[model samples]
Target: MTATAVAASVPVARGYRFELVKLWSQRRVRLLLLTCWAGPALFVAAVSQQSTLPVDTLFGRWMHATGWAGPLVTLGFAGTWALPLLTSVVAGDVFAAEDRLGTWRHLLLAVRSPRRIFAAKVLASLTVIMLLVAGLAAGSTAGGLLTVGNHPLVGLDGHPLAPADAAGTVLLAWICVLAPTLALAAIGLLGSVALGRSPMGLLLPVLVALGLQLAQMMPLPVPVRVALPGYAFIAWNGLFTSPAQLGPLLIGITVSLVWAVTAAGLAYRIFLRRDFTDQAYDGAGRRALTSGLLPLAGVLVVTIAVIVPVTGGPSSGIEQDKVQRSVATAFAHLYRLQTEQLHRPAVTEVQLDTSAACTRGGGRLEPQGPGNDWRCVVSWHLPGVPAAGSATYQLDLTPDGRFMADGDGPKEVNGYFLVRTPAGDAPNPLWQFDGTVALLPTVPKG
Candidate 1:
């Protein structure tokens, strides 16, 4: 490279090293890293000793059944608040702390350019965030294997995943989550630069995350919810299903990138224009607000434009046929587990020839959308039994295509919440099952 280029790159490299050293010296950053490495394992150990399981979270009920469930369950819980908090604590405070310490002026007067300093801080913060995520993933995997044992994991689609497949899926799920976590870190950086206060910078990104989560739970349009930042966190659910739904995953990555770039770019603009010499200077006036809002508005418009083409078509809603197929397949797999627990001959899902008829709100509404009032009657055949058996299930579904189905079959078979096994009374897989439905259209099976 030319001499000028080499000279220019030196400042960024030096600034990056300096920023890393600054982060390493902080007590809170060191403590947070340690916690990330140990917290999930500790949680798994505690859960293993308890009789009650966290059945609400995905893979929660299977914590004791498979070592793989520990990381997955922890991932589900982390998406709500832990991830946002983890990213914000560092990125939010990194820039603003310099202001509080009155070190910004000295840093600006140094040989490093403001742009190079900004780049260095961003790189350092992202590196730290990646480490924290890796720590959590490794810790949870180790904890689960040690405490729960490496048993086969039951997939969301009711199929049993071998140990190797389960491990790969768990790893992939964590990797998928990294995109949104980085996006949240970018938001924290934006808050830190704009607010110029350590406390607000740390808290603002977390509050924004909380708000997005609340909006997700509300009854909003499918396209709108998909466009939100929080959707990326839960989109990893698709990974645990058979065939692995990639549509939501793709959309999530796109949405997160848009937010991250927009936030970081605005922060860069503000940092470049601010008069650092003035101690009383603040970046919170009408002009600043307008500048920020205009870019955000444009971002939203672009996001919608991209999302509508992918998710706006008429075939985007829930399909009854798909739901019935998913319910039937899940029931068949769980029924085989139930039979095995009873010491009966195990039946394969195909041999059972399972089929289901589902309806919403007592048949008053179309069973094509998200609602809690859905019901299905699943019927299947068993070898040596002339008469076919049937069971009724109540399904509570969410906008994001996840559902919990409660079966009303005979207690001696699949109705009881718990089934007795040689190990002890474990959760009856057939009693209540969780599964996901693809929102996008798929080719019909013959």
Candidate 2:
């Protein structure tokens, strides 16, 4: 048949079959799947053998108490790197392998349509991803049940669930992660197609994930931060909480779907537009690298150079004035919580003069950025105290408008004090009783 006739026929079924063969024929693919499937089991075994749990994670504290906690802990840790790596292994190479093998020119003629080929590759990659996620969920659930007792799971909502009910919730959490997992797969495919190399395709997606995680720590607006893919990846944590809010989960799934479709579509367009007949460029690895990556690197460098100055300038950077205001506000909240804890009458933040004289070390206060340490003299009113009292505190600030302070104030430094809550609310009961909390001095209103 003529090339034109073959193009007109565009056999999607045959294309899909070929793609599946390409994926399964490789021994490396089998090894990767084996690794992914076995990872959760190994984790469960190691964690069960340990004497203590890593209580920093949401489900870690209860991991030793029930088998149900295994799935939750495994999900938390795997989402960090393993899921992305597993999906990227295939998605990153699906398209680029054709170029690396110099098969694109022949395939272009035989496949009829780039879009169909791209679709088939994506379908195969996503199929593998689904299996990977399923393996993780199954292995984690089975390992947990066998290693630990299948007792009831105490959910984040402080409610207890029967074994069957907890199993259902665990499945839902796994399903929640599948969308983000596919989204990462799509991103990996796009990077592979766009970069047209196995290494770049594999490495770039992981780097993008890391970059998104860092962006979450920046002082970005709430809406902007929530819109990021990383937000959706982590949003699944809310499912274990009481009442199990589904809003964030639904939003995360939607955002991930949109990103996946958009990225894959763009990758298809680029693949269709590129010429595959240039043997010299396609065969020579360095030529392809220099031609494709150099300009992209230059643009990225320029963008960073411009963004750093604008965002890091005096106008936008942390300043002494902002620090004083923030410290005063933080202290007011802290003081109110302390008063409440001490059973004193509630006084409004405005009534407590929280003015602070902050200085760096023993020198005058200097304009600085996040992570700087400082000392402050906080003057405030104690309940029924006739005169204003002063306390010294050591403060450390973060770029994201968050801070930590150590109280050197009398008797208070050694016992429980108030610290800012994760949501920036005051009087957070969870942190109210922490002994290491610092006091924010507040003066009595005239």
Candidate 3:
């Protein structure tokens, strides 16, 4: 047989495109896509009104507030349930669906090469995941275009990134954030291959994803945290800061890719070797679950052992930031001090803005009405302790609560403070009922 003839006779497998066509023909996948498209927008609308959308940046052109949906989709919520569940909705079921419908045998016989067929399976799954992520970004951008009109975007970092750069950066962040989540999809697909029953594959990854997130949140050391794929995902947030960096993000992407490919290989091997297993577990046409469960359990146990520590120990850079507050007010004074020993900053026109923290909990601080210019921050079930700006400390009551003590330094002295809310015209300030103090040092101790 000539090369061309052999190729023609063997049939060039086009990979995911064929898989995508098969998936698209299914009503479930299509409904999944539609739900993905509409879901985020609706959620954002429910949480926030369309009119009050803040412009993406300071230099940003006047646009509608519903425009917030664009960036909001790129924020934490979108990454949490929206994208992972969306990917899982397909990936979790991709392999198992055929089994449920009794088409696995016909499909396997159609492709002939299990490796090629597995590759196509993976390709289609990834394509679906990628499209859903891209669609989230695109749909919101289009909605923004329709609702507010396309204008230049400013990045989370106040630097004036080009509109394209800003859009691309947000999109890239969303994709990179998927590093940890992809492993869920990969392992789920592996379950699909090995278990032969679709539900067996789908059910496990959802449980694992949810379980792992909880496990990963424990106080662990940095190296331990860095080892887990989940650690890399949240840590990639370093890219959003003023000086954008990708070191951890690059590391994250590398780790996710490694795990995913390895899982893909394992899944392929399972599909290839599945027929040789004992026939006692099922009748002639069905695949067995016993083989799948052990590997799944082993991986789960080992990963949980490693990752639970990673989650339970001291946080990595990002997790530490997320776990703790930066601008805490502590009350400390020099051991001995005279009346004249205390002196506040020469020019103490400090403006403390706790708006970001309050805004985090869906509570808006009005600029000029009752509760206007108030500083209240979200502490319950928040993603991160909001960084407070515009806070200034002038005095510290001595430990004995007798004389006032002022540490000598610049107004932005790098230390902690415990503050007593002096009366301000802005309205009632929520205090600790005692005093709230945190470890917010302007400069980190060496």
Candidate 4:
């Protein structure tokens, strides 16, 4: 059979199958697959044995006890570099492996078309990445249930999630990450096609992922940050929380698709126009890179320019009335919890007044921005204590909508005071009341 006839006989799907089979035959690929399915058990064991949690990562604080937190913790670590590395392993080498082995020239002449080859390579890389993620998710979920137990999971709102619900939520979060993972894979493919070297292709995409993660950490404009892939990576954290905000998740999906598709398109254009005859290491490499990367760079600049000004910042200033209501409601709920700790009378919503004049730095507090200098004059009645007269509270608003307030309360000798002391003892109680209160955003009543 002629080479042309053989190539012509193979459909796009067959080409993809062949590429996948070639990858699967590699010893290194098999080892990577094994690691993907096995690493999570080790992670579970290590985390279980630790006395302290890795609070630096999202969901890390809850990992010690909740069976569901295992996947969340894994995602946090994966967001840093693991996902990028896993997806890049196949993508970085798929195209360059052809060049490195001096097979591109033969394939270029014999293959049905460059477009078919490009599509086949992309499908193969995506299949490997999907498998890697699936293995990790399955391993992590199994290890967590085995070691941590399927207890009810605590959410961001301090509410409890049923074990069944928690399990489903974790699965959804993993699905959410797939978009960005594919984007990372696309990035590696771009590097592979552009540089035509396996090692550089593998390393550059991971470096770019790292750069995007850094950009997320810095105080870039919200639009710019959200436009980046890292934003989607971290946004998955919200799914574990009560009253889960789906807006970020939707935005992340859209942005990730845009980035992956655009990047893959750029890479495809380069591959489609590539000349197999002029296979010089330097000149061809430079041309491939310049042609592939320049358009994407232009797209990024134009995107930033258009989005930054449109999403500069909140223009309609903060309304103190809304702030007062929100703060007071949050305080009432948190105070009820604190009362429970002290074994006191339950505080109800009807017992509290949500009206107050709030101020920041001696000015009418606008609902916008974060500051350490907000004050609210609030009044509430306890069971025995009379109208604990309108007291002045110093409120510190965080950018994430949480507030901590220290209010002027009953006068004390020093620090906190105990309610009941042991008879015949030095009147020292096991618990005491402090004047500080921490408030979270008001969870909507069902």
Candidate 5:
């Protein structure tokens, strides 16, 4: 029989819809789907019932653990492992499943061309992937809203965001996060096609993902990090805070697409040419990558090489502003605490020991309270001079409202205190209180 005659005898595929049905009817595919939906609901339910999740954080608590709880939790749930695995279920099986079952020849014979057969398989795999992802998004979003409501979103970056805007960002963020897995799916499908092993298509991409994840976490060059498919999953970091991070997410999606296409193209070429008859169904695999994907791999390599030098910071001395602010805030808390704590209160008591005060701590600090009320405390111990021999002294005030220092150690010592004026009034400090020489109201050291 002539090659042309053999090819001509095969039937053309009517549409992807027919292939979709054939793919969907598989028991494994149905089970994969059922598990995906059930797992999320069970997770949300268990968490909601047991969680002490800050329900009162000004964002109305989840109305139902299932509805509003899912989307909110999905970042942690699916972004890590579920999405990638979910994708692999179909991708690893798409083309390879036929080969594993010894049905590849039958499929090619029916479709008339390897290209059409590959298309139908890819189409089916992608359809399943898209639906599964959509299902996750829909179920989780609805769960989160039902349980948590459409209140303002508190983002990963510690900023509060309105739900209307946050919803868009969250959706974008999740989709972008999906890019890495989507890319893996493409690669896995290729593995399915090339290896004729259902598990290899699923497992190999995951191992690669793990390897990339490890590499991603290391202190690699910025360009290297940017090129990783695993980079998109890191976007979950942005879920808690925003001005939604679009920059890294966008770059990650590009990297994912490149890897995905490269894998898919190679799979396509191998499937079209490689003879299956009498070929070992185990151990051996496609030996070469296709010509079409070479450019993509080259571009990735070139981009990483070029970008590393320009963005890597110059080796030099520097001061970070973030550290400075943190130090200042610490100073503020300490200053307030000491000032309030150190100052001794007099309840018509006898003579009390007093200490000298320093105006400020080491850091550059501005006085916070009203005019000249910028009082500070220091641990002071007056030395060298002996006690004033327990001299009993009387205190008196002058007409100009100055408490005369007629007592032993000069009557009144003036110090700063915070005093506020009436509303719409200028800032002022009233009656500078004396830290020393307490005017005891006829009370003694009894």
Candidate 6:
């Protein structure tokens, strides 16, 4: 067929199929899928045989107790860098590979329109990304179940979830991560089109993710932090709580959509306008980098300017009221478990009438906001005891509203580091616990 006839006959779907075939034929893409599927299983098996648990990660402490914990723990760890790096490997290289091979001119001639080619590449990249995530989630869950057995899961709110319910929640948590992962992929796509170099394209999105992570650690305004794509990675924490906090999840979805649309739209515009002539490719590196970076920098500056003026408060989204409530609720639920372990009478959260008074820096600073020095004095009523029982806890909080709290309490109840149970000594459910407060403002119950 003639070049003109071929270009005229080719549809977006045909181009999309060509891109998909190209991706599937690459060894790196196949290797990525294999690693995603097998890596978690191996890690879970290794960890199961170890003497120590990954207590630092959310749900890590419960890995041995429940199969569902493995995927959630893996999810937490992956959010840090794995997700971004995995997506970037494909999205970042898809377009740049054409540049490297000097095939863009031929591909464009065949496809006729850069717009159609861009759409095809994007669709193919996104499809592969989704598959990668699904493989990760499935592999983690399968590994956990095989190694640990399907036991009851201790949730973030200190409630026990049935195996079936825990499985559903774990899957849902993975689903929630898709929005931000896709946004990062879109950013990677932008880098690929802009830099027209595989190395820079692959690393740019990962670097951006790292920068956003560091920014989240800073005391940026609550709105500003929530608006960042990085925040959506940890937004799944809310799903593990009882009466799950949907505020952060909702905000994360919205923010991720905005980022994906903005970055992808910019990439589309740039791709459509680029010259693919053999001569134009000779001295295009400097021009391409300048054109790509300048618009992105401008967009970021305008976004920050708009966001900062509207939400300038220094509050870290880790508000005192929300933290106190989250801690108190988790404490009540765990205390009941402790009581059950002791063969004591059953108790409910409401009957405990739990309340916590929290402060930071020994009251030198306000109780609200994120800090390492947060301390809370929790008081609750026991059924037969005349005096109210109290325990002190030291909390280290992150800007995204997740905190690790260590109880300073009576050794008999809290038990040094491990709590005594019928199954010998196990990690204390209350001695140290992790919990997340809804970052968005919530309505007080009447």
Worst 10 residues of 1 by lDDT: 1-10
Residue range 1-446, candidate 2, lDDT tens digits: 11222437457778888888888899988877786688787788679668776655556656666888888888877777778777678887888788778887678678776677777888887787788788888888777888887987755433457898888888888888888777778778777777775477777667877887788567553344445555566777556544454654666677677667666665665566666666433322454345444543453344344334323332323455555655555566556655565566897766776677777755654555454467666676655768876666676654433355556655452123333444452322222111110111122224
Task: Score candidate 1 by lDDT.
Answer: 0.81
Give the Å error, residue 224, model 2: 1.7
Worst 10 residues of 6 by lDDT: 1-10
The TM-score measured for candidate 6 stands at 0.92
What's the candidate order when arranged by decreasing lDDT? 1, 6, 4, 2, 5, 3
lDDT of each: 0.81, 0.64, 0.46, 0.65, 0.50, 0.81
Measured over all alpha carbons after superposition, the RMSD of each candidate to the real structure, in angstroms, is 3.3, 9.6, 13.0, 6.8, 19.0, 2.9
> Candidate 2 at 133: error in angstroms?
1.3
TM-score of 2: 0.64
| Best candidate (score: lDDT) | 1
lDDT of 6: 0.81
Please identify model 1 stretches exceeding 4 Å from their true place.
1-10, 312-316, 420-426
| TM-score, candidate number 4 | 0.74
RMSD of 6: 2.9
Top of the candidates by TM-score: 1
Across 334-383, the per-residue lDDT of candidate 6 in tens digits comes to 98888887667898888899888898999899777788999988899998
Per-residue accuracy of model 1 over 287-332 as CA lDDT, tens digit each: 5456565776677667766777677563435779989988987888
Which residue segments of model 2 deviate by more than 4 Å?
A: 1-10, 281-446
Q: What TM-score does candidate 5 reach?
A: 0.63
